[model samples]
Target: MATLEIKEVAKRYGDRTVLHDINLTLASGEFLSLLGPSGCGKTTLLRIIAGFEHPDGGQVRVDGQDITALPANRRQMGMVFQAYSLFPNMTAEENVRFGLRVRKVDAAEQSRRVLELLELVGLANHAAKYPHQLSGGQQQRVALARALAIRPSLLLLDEPLSALDAKVRVQLREEIRRIQRETGITTVFVTHDQEEALSISDRVAVMYEGRMVQVGAPAAIYQEPTHPFVAQFIGISSRLPARVVDADQGVITVLDRALHTPRARGLQPDVALHLYLRPEGVQLQAVNGKDPQSAVLQGTVRESTFFGAVTRLRVELDGGQGVLADLSTHEALQLPIGIRVHVSWQPDAMRLLPAELPI
Candidate 1:
């Protein structure tokens, strides 16, 4: 276990800047995920930390030592890339033992360590199976075991699960988290998948256009996003156009209702804003009467998607704007596409962000 620090790290490729002045710190054994879209620089930052790429400025430190100039092999870190990268002719045991053999560890110790890691990754029974004989998931497990064989001070994963199928990805991610906790190795995971990052990380760092936009625990980042990009990128949410009708009272008009949000407190009147309404915050009701006077809003379902316990819907409102409503699977059965329904939201669940956004 070790504390990792990245201080003012910046990177550039010719005229294009790959990373901005980024600063982050992780406690011993802490697991942090860098999450963003395809070109958002998360991978670049990970490579910089892994010593594969040098930053134009700043430093990378582990346990108070500035290792910015250290070669990757000397950094004492284990890395798992998206590709399994296992040796084709080598069996699981031999693959995991390769690092130990290169480091000139005692032969007896290498055998013990290889077996221990193969067991740790739940591959002890398949130790003699070559890479070609293993499934994608199994091959990844061997790669993970090989990386852990060195008992590295740090573990870096660059979307290691992306190449696998969805179901396998979930299972392997959970397995990875368990292995991480058992080993207590400080880990830096880079991925574009929000669910993966949110599900298994101690903390999540959201980056956009090479800048770290927000960093927080999973729930905090989901519930209280500080940036508009963070709010939009992290989950499914609807943005209803609104206007700040009364800033003095922190009031904003959404559809027909005047809702109060602290974010509207200092905004000028009539300034355009977007009210972020999460699907889970909405409640759908059958319209039994004309006008539906008790309803907060009304819309026709544009899309309905059932996700096990809950069903998410895209409801198109009166003026072509839309909001997503999440309903019980039983209730969603009653409402299909093009069905009109009443929509009401829990005020505490909505968030307000600046209407304008970066391109």
Candidate 2:
């Protein structure tokens, strides 16, 4: 186990800059995930950490030792790529033993380590099978075992589960987390999938166009996103136009209804604002009786979609604005389309941001 640090990292390709002033620190045995959309520089940052690519300007350190100039082979890092890079002619056991053989470990130690890694990845019985005879999931397990056989100080996973089927991806992700915990290895996983990053990481760093937008625990990133980009990108949300009626008092007016909100810095009175509300934050109730503590907006159900235990309803406000509300399937069926309903949410559930902010 070791601590990993990336300080002031920057990368550029010709005139386009992909990474800018990237700085992050990982504690010993911590699992940190780099999450973003395609072309967001997550994979590039991972390559820099693995010593596969040099940063234009920065330092990569492991346990207080500078490794920015170290070559890939001497960095003590193990990388598992998206495609299974197993040798087709090598059996599973031999593939796991190859790393040890490169380092010239004795035959006895190599054999013991191979057995342990195969068992660790739950491929002990298939030790004699070659990559050609194994399933995609099995092949990935072999690759993981091979990466771990050398006992690297850091483990880098570059979208290692993207090519598998949905079921297999979920299963393998859980297995990877289990193995990481068992070995307590410092890991950096790069993925474009938000669910994967949120489900398995101790901390998540959300990136956008060469810059990190937010870094926090999964719940924090989901519940309290500091930037408008983060609130919209991290989850499903409905945006409605609003106005800051009283900035000092943290009051806003939406759809001609006055409501109090949290104070935001740099907000001025009478400025146009955008209110962001998550589906789970919006509540639907019959229009007759209403909750006084919540801010209510009258709307009619436009459509409802059932997704197993949960149902999502699209409600169109009297002003022609649409908002989404999530409810139990049982409850949603009680209210059909065209039925008048009251949409309400807690004051704290809505986020206020400048309307000019892009995305």
Candidate 3:
């Protein structure tokens, strides 16, 4: 296992910057995911780490040794690209053994290692199958086996499961996590799927535009987001405008309702802000026979989306502001379209961001 360090990494093309002074460190055997939308520079950073792309400024170090100038072949970093780049002429076993052969390992050793890896990825039964004969998931398994056959100190996976079907993606992600744990290799995975990152990674780094915004445990990233982008990206959230009514006590006014949230602490009075609330945190109840005092916000159910155990309802408030609330299927059934409802949430379940942002 090796420790990976990226220090003050920066990249630009012509007048536009792609990454700005990015810095991150990975502990040996830690699995970290670079999660963001398209063109957020996550793939670019992975390419730089794999020695596929050169960084204009900053160094990439593995185990305290400078590897920024090292070529891809000499870096001993195994990379699985988005596309499973398997040779059509090669069988699964041969694909897994290719790296060992390239490294000049003896034929007997290559055969032994290939069999072991095929078994590790649960593809030993399909070892002799050609790429064209195997399913998408099976081909990806071969690709992973090939990457691991080199026994590289670091592993880089760039959206390796993005091409698989939903069920296969779930199963393969679990398999990948198990293999990483058994091999204990420091790994970096890049993906845009929030659920994928949250379910598998030890820590997730959320990137936006070209910068890494927040890095933390999956639970923290989802429940205690420090950035507006992270709050909106990790889950379904509704952003509402608010004004700081009392900075010392962390009181903010939203739609004539004053709520106190720790996230609003230290803001100057009269400061405009954006309040972010997740769907699960917003509580919605039927307005029929309900006490008016309990209704902090009133709205009409505009849309209902079924999602297995929970259904999300989009409510259009009195002033035309819309917010989302997730309720159980049974509860959602009781509140159909055109039904009036009241909405409220606990104070700690929200985060605040400055109202002004780049348009």
Clash list (residue pairs), candidate 3: none
Over the stretch 1-359, how does candidate 1's per-residue lDDT look in tens digits? 99999999999999999899999999999999999999999999999888999999999999999999998989999999999999998999999999999999999999999988888888899999999999999999999988998889999999999999999999999999999999999999999999999999999999999999999999999998878899899998888888998999998888867666677887889978788888898888767676554467778998988899998888898788888888898989898898888887776568887788743
Off by over 4 Å in 1: 266-270, 288-295, 334-339
Overall lDDT per candidate, in order of appearance? 0.91, 0.91, 0.91
Q: How close is candidate 2 to the true structure, as a TM-score?
A: 0.95
Supply every candidate's count of residue pairs whose N, Cα or C atoms clash at under 3 angstroms: 0, 0, 0
Report the error of model 3 at residue 1, Å.
1.3
By summed lDDT, the worst window of 10 consecutive residues in model 3 runs over 288-297
* Model 2, span 1-359: residue lDDT tens: 99999999999999999999899999999999999999999999999999999999999999999999999999988899999999998999999999899999999999999999999999999999999999999999999999999999999999999999999999999999999999999999999998999999999999988888899999899888877777878888898989988777777788998777665435788888788898887888877665455646889999999899999999999999999999899999988999988788865567887777553
Ranking by lDDT: 3, 2, 1
* Model 1, residue 229: C-alpha shift (Å): 1.4
lDDT of 1 at 169: 99
What TM-score fits each model?
Answer: 0.94, 0.95, 0.96
RMSD of 2: 1.8
